[model samples]
Target: MSINDHRLVQCNEKDEETLLIFKKGINDSYNGKISTWSTKKDCCAWEGVSCDNITGRVTELDLKQHFLEGEMNMSILKLEFLSYLDLSFNEFDVIRIPSIQDNITHTSNLLYLDLSFNSYVSSLSLAWLSAHSSLKYLNLSGIDLHKETNLLQAVNTLPSLLELHLSECNLNNFITNPFMEYLNLSSLLTLDLSKNNFSSQLPNQFFNQTKDLTYLDLSWNNIHGSIPHSWKNMKYLDYINLWSNKLSGEALVHLSGWKQLRIMNLGENEFSGTIPINMSQILKVVILRANQFEGNIPTQIFNLSYLFHLDLADNKLSGSIPKSVYNLTQMIKFTMNDRTMAVVELFTKGQEYEVQQIETNRQTIDLSANYLSGEVPSELFHLVQLQTLNLSRNNLIGTIPKIIGGMKNLESLDLSNNKLCGEIPQSMSLLNFLEYLNISYNNFNGKIPTGTQLQSFNASSYIGNPKLCGAPLENCNIKEQNPKTPTTSMKNEDGDSIRESLYLGMGVGFAAGFWGICGSLFLIRKWRHAYFRFVDGVGDKLNVTLMVKLNRFH
Candidate 1:
């Protein structure tokens, strides 16, 4: 239980008693996450507790998602050596954040603190955090901070802070002026202020100073107006999400300078004008749906080989789908690295889905609700690794090519409300992985191809097509007309030959009888005369018989 000359034991006796006291206050009856905190055992060996090897003092306490309920006990704060503490996702009904006026000497060594998602803990004041200058990461997400004033000015005191997450914290009151006259967070890399009540224009000066930011999320706010030109100063930004805001204008042209940007989401905004063609070449995901953007979709968008997800739905884009879509070879084969994983919210099969972690082979292309026309490019099926393909509610025409069967990995497919005609490709039956399908409201005809997967969907999938029929729909009922066999042909030929023979025999017999009678009359005069006499004698005998009968009657 000792190390290094036995000067320091496994855990200090005072820290062990403090941890036991901390456990007593928590109602761990549900999960019993801290059951090992016993007097007989070393406190450092307990779950979610880590101690300094040489100092024998608890330095890290992680109790996230432990299902422990009760008011937070301040006894754990006595461990002055603690540098990391997490109480996120617990059932704590009330938590009084330590104020600078209180005895916060124990938090002097704190480097990281997370109290996020303890929903019942409503009010928050970050005045005490200003004293913890050594703190590098702080997350108070899902905690209400509406009452706090001068919040940014208070956080500016932490010179070492790198990542700050205040999402869903109700910090709308202080966000109006998120910066001070002298900005101090030059080293900050990630900042998330999403799902707040920011009803004002975007802070113009704030972006000018946060040049070191690599990740910025201000989504789900009431922020209006164009993105400030100062945003171009954030050259290091790799991910930026301003989704579900009231932001408008063609100001995205300012992003031409962001060479390091990898994921950009400006969806569900009031943005108008054509999509920018000067997008970063290395961007992996771009979501610009539900905007007023019009004009042909830039072919340059397909030039991005690394792009696996592109959502341009609910726009006014016209013209044919660019055949250059086949250039997205990376989406067909590339294996994404762990650093490239992103969370994306996409609309597929009439529902919105949030994919927590995008996988390497999971690709999507949504061009629905656009003005796009002409045949669907066969090149689109080249992305065999695609998972969702939605081209619905467009002016698209022509048949779905048989090559679509190559996309066997498809899980959701929607081509509804288009002018597409012809039979649903028989090759589509090979797509055994299809889970959601909508081909309704098209000019499609003929029986639906047979397959367990195709038939599994409801009749609605085939609705709006009067000519389409089969299992999921009503039966076609029409039987096939096959070609005649050799046997049937030979039987008809034999019957014709028999009738010809009978007619020939009858004609030959009549000719022979007539010739025989004529030849006898010409060659033999006696026979000819006898034949005439026999006929006359018969006539005379008949006449004599008639005369005798008349005489008898008289």
Candidate 2:
């Protein structure tokens, strides 16, 4: 032990000695935070240290996101009374996880341990965790665990564990039998195995033991095959995320009985077939984007009163958007990407980014790049909470809803690449929050709306609409024509008016060209003299030609 360790151990009280050792370890490790830890002050009041009321012993040490660096010395293991330890979100890149296998058995009372976001941790470091029989919550997210082959086996040793998060751990394979054993533990409720390289399909009996599972995330893994019907056994499940996988076959039917399910995300998969009409009524979110599901959306889906998020984009689903969707006042997110399923993104600070979930009440609807036809239903505007709307790359026709302004919260709108005709809705000017607007490649005529928000959009928003004109585009009508000339007005009242406008535009163009040359000559003395000389030569030649013709005739 060093001089500092000796001083820490010199505390008169046993509890004080334990805390002093812990404090010394923290101070010696890094300096980003925990400056409040000093022997002059009560250890109980030190930052991130919590003491038991009756025993006056430190029970918890939470230094999460403190930017702490350097090696984690074993001095912390001296806290025999410590029950919780969180050193998450710190810069421990230079420190390998201390081999605690020899010492953890002495500190078996620890119930919670979170070392998440410490990138230097390795797979072997986790073996010591199994020694703590009392451990309930373990989060090792963002750790390098590629070499740990018996992850499930190690976790199974902690029967008291309730929530295990190993996300972003570089986990490649798992022992299915051990995982099943871990799942069988009645205490386990949440498990996150996301962002791994698990390429194998899930065992058919994987969920057989997950009776108490409430939250399960297997997203961003290389797992393949159809979803097992056995998952229906987990009646207590509330959240299931299998996003960005190779899951195929018609798996929605197996989930129909998940009455307790709240959020179900099977997006970015290979599942095909129509969405089940008889899904769980209690579902709050349903994301099935980027699949091959075809046919009309089931009307029963709109009846899900509790459903808020429905992402069926990037699929082959056909038919018009159901108007009954207006009933979902709880709707916060809805998407159907017009491009490929994977290209949907959110814009923030003028930057494009993807979101795993929506945390706000901003309503969104995207039905772009589909075969749906017909005019956009006016009832859609009835969703007063509506925010973003996209109906681009479809076969829909007819003018936009005149009362779209009713959606007071509208922000982004994309109506590009369709056969929509007629003037844009003037009520669109009422969209105060509108930030992005794209109505290009449509048959729309007349002037683009001139709202501050509307005019802020780039000219690309109105491109391909030849007849549409305004700022962001050419002016609706240029008034530079000569007053005496019969010019055409670009008014759409009648066919005759359109013809006259065309003729008038041509005449104005001709007069402007003629005067442009004449004015240039008059403005410059040299050019004026050159112009006169050329004109006189031409006149003399013309007169000589006329005289010659007359003489020949005589």
Candidate 3:
């Protein structure tokens, strides 16, 4: 058979409904990686296109971040063999409802779907996914799902669902329906509802009831009031992020029980009290910034052998950072940026990795913008994978450690508003990847080196230090030497020497006047004779000059 005839023969067995759906997806540019529209058999190798070898069934369809620009269409439902599908990260502008489920019902074997980062409305996709009993994983992030209060009520319909991600979807309307009440997501291991407007009082059973959940993210929302004691039951949860909200009450004692949690971010809230002492055992990353916590961190906080990132900024916490942190050589990333809820991500194998399998906790420690003082620990200079190091807006003093130049991977350094002194290190010129440098508002002196990173920084980054001069300053020649700033000496102020001479002259005149009033020495003949004899004895006598002057007059 001819090649074109052979291609036609291959596609002849596909169901008419499936053929129509595939044609519509190709028309929509959803399968954009396909450069040309050819016969089904000819287009099977296109991006996001997958097929079963024996059955010739189009089973998997993944079109993520493909920039396939168009409105979404329901035609996707016709491919009954689709067991794994991803249409996320594409520019989907509208909803697409197709009579595809009935076709899938005939096939009876579909699983794994991700329509996240698209423009589907809230109830449209959630309702459909809930009804798919065969779906094991569903992700709909950044899609603004806001159609119903009991949005996930359809979840009760699915029994095989294991992972559901609904992050950044708008779930904040007053849907009087008790959405969290009816569902039993017992098999679920991960659920994400972070970055939403959900303000409804969360039912107590929301987390406590989720016994099988291992990862939960409810950050950047309005979920408030004291954390329920019911959360003590989440045994499998390994990560919890509750950042950027208004939850308060006794924090330290309440959070220590999650013995399995490895990553916890409770920063940017209104919690108070001492940092929990025994809390170090469970975590690899702990962020407790922007709260009312106080007192020294328990010395054991550093002993968490798994810990890589520890942030405790923007609090009333006092005292030195425990030196034990230096022992954390296994630590890959450590941060100290000014008070802010850091949204850092950790991945395996970073710059500090000896073996590529080790995990990196970037931006993990932020101790800036607090009352923290004392010299920066040199041991912290070892974290070469750190991205942002902010020692700004604190009372920290002394020179920037020379070892800090070893952090070749550091991007942003903010030592501003400190009592710190000394020249900006010339060794900093070697940070090839270093992008942003802010030593501004500090007591730093000398020239800022003319490297790509330092030269690119604006003059504002070096402000408030009159002693500092270089590329940012007009008078660049002052690069000669950075002088140690002198302080005023503590000595008594005295009058000028010229003034003292005048005082001495005045004293002599007064004494001479006093003697004249008592009896001028000239009036004392014996005194006069003694003075004349002494004068006459030395060199030529004064009388000889006097006689010469008399002879000239004669």
Candidate 4:
């Protein structure tokens, strides 16, 4: 058949009608390009609608992130042959899932169902989901499932389920004991229950059943207590996020056997004790910040060449940073999530830009708010891709290395609250991309560097460094106000000497003039008589002039 003939083939009339009705149910304000679902065009060519090649029946209706509004019409149920249905990230205004009886009317062959990111939808029950036996990938995240008391029980029924994402779905009532007998979901690979209210110790029986699970995210929930040792059997597990929870104990020590593990986040929890020493080599991102993990960082962690982000901040961790840190050339950000100090993201439109935009290759190192004491490691300067370097609030001493300028990508640098002395490196002027700098409360002295980027900063950047001077600080070469000093005293003495010499010269000149005139008068008697006659005539003229002026005035 010619390509044009294939293109002309029309979609099933029933499927077209169903899709047209579905389009009508949506609000006109919806931003998605579903307007092309007109009868004039082939339904197979319509946006968000895909047809089966053989049957010409609609099988996929993907309208993800469309900003769509209004309720979902039951007309979609007419497409019983549909296998992939994705309405994720759309603005469905609190439309609840249809009841089991209504859903059962049309036995859908749905294999992938995604209604994630629809926050308004409240309540999910086993009855609504049990009708779909062929479902494998089910994502109902951001839905309110607080009242769904039999949540786990319903999930247990989906024998063919492979991936389940129930994140942010108020699963507060779901709790099971470690020994509780649960139906095994051996085929499941991904399970996400993060940002929920699952307040209870992790049930070992649950993870024990899903041994084939590769990705698990229980972060930002109320899952408390230690992770049970039984989870060690899930050897295939790769990614796990247990951050922002009340999970405690040395549970991480048990997860060493999971060789496939890569990303692990246990930050903002109560996990005490040293970081697990027997971590897998394939690990990439490890964040255990805001915990009480004491003792030195495990040297083995740095050997993970693929490791990108390592955040052990806000812990009681002591000892110097391991020398192996320099080996992490690919390390993008390494922090110890401490208070006030941070690895900042320099986004243009505030924090929102960070979420919407693609991530840039930013390298950072934050060892702030620790008892780590020693010379600032020279190896740090070699990480040329570094953007943020924060070593604030430590017992670090010695001068900042001049080679810091080699990190041309540096956007933020903070070395505040340390015992670092010596002059601020003039080489720092080479960092044209530097946007934020805080070297406050250090023993740094001498003139501040003069670069447009450096001078543009405020006085706070150099505050508490009483000896530091220049723009953004006081000028170092300003003259003192002391007039009694040796320089001023010498100036005063010179002035006195000049005054005495002037007096002496004037007296000599006066005497010489007087003696010359007297001697002249003594030698010549006629001269003395003439001088007296001249004086007498001048006095007579002065008297006559005064009298004439006085008479005129009268």
The best candidate by lDDT is 1
Highest TM-score model number: 1
In candidate 3, what are the lDDT values of residues 448-473, reduced to their tens digit? 87777678767887888888887866
Query: Which pairs of residues collide in model 3?
Result: 122-145, 335-365
Which window of ten consecutive residues has the lowest lDDT sum in model 1? Answer: 1-10
In candidate 4, which residue ranges exceed 4 Å CA deviation? Answer: 1-6, 30-32, 74-77, 94-108, 177-180, 332-360, 479-554
lDDT of 4 by residue, 74-148 (tens): 447558788998999887774544454545467769899898886566654546666677789999899887876
Task: List lDDT for all candidates, in order.
Answer: 0.82, 0.72, 0.66, 0.75
- Clashes by residue pair, model 4: 313-336, 313-337
Taking the tens digit of each residue's C-alpha lDDT, what string does model 1 give over 1-554?
Answer: 21222334688887888778778768888877677577676777787888887888888899999887886765466677889999999888776444445455544788899989987788766676765788899998998888877688778888888988899988675555645546676879888898897898877667766888798888888999888888877778898888899999985676689889989898999998887789888888889999988888888898888888899999888999987746676567756544453556877656888775665466889999999999998888878888889999999999999999998789999999999999898999999899899999999988898889899999999899998888888888644223357897799789899999999999999999999999889899899899999999999999999999999999
- Can you give the lDDT of residue 96 in candidate 1? 48
Alpha carbon deviation, residue 210, candidate 2 (Å): 0.9
Q: After the best TM-score superposition of candidate 4, give how far the Cα of residue 357 lies from its true spot, in angstroms.
A: 10
- Residue clash pairs of candidate 2: 313-336, 487-504, 488-501, 488-504
Instruction: Give the residue spans of candidate 3 off by over 4 A.
Output: 1-12, 15-19, 25-35, 69-75, 98-104, 120-131, 173-176, 280-282, 304-308, 330-364, 422-433, 445-458, 466-554
The global Cα lDDT (0 to 1) of model 3 is 0.66
Give per-model TM-scores: 0.82, 0.77, 0.74, 0.77
So what's the TM-score on candidate 1? 0.82
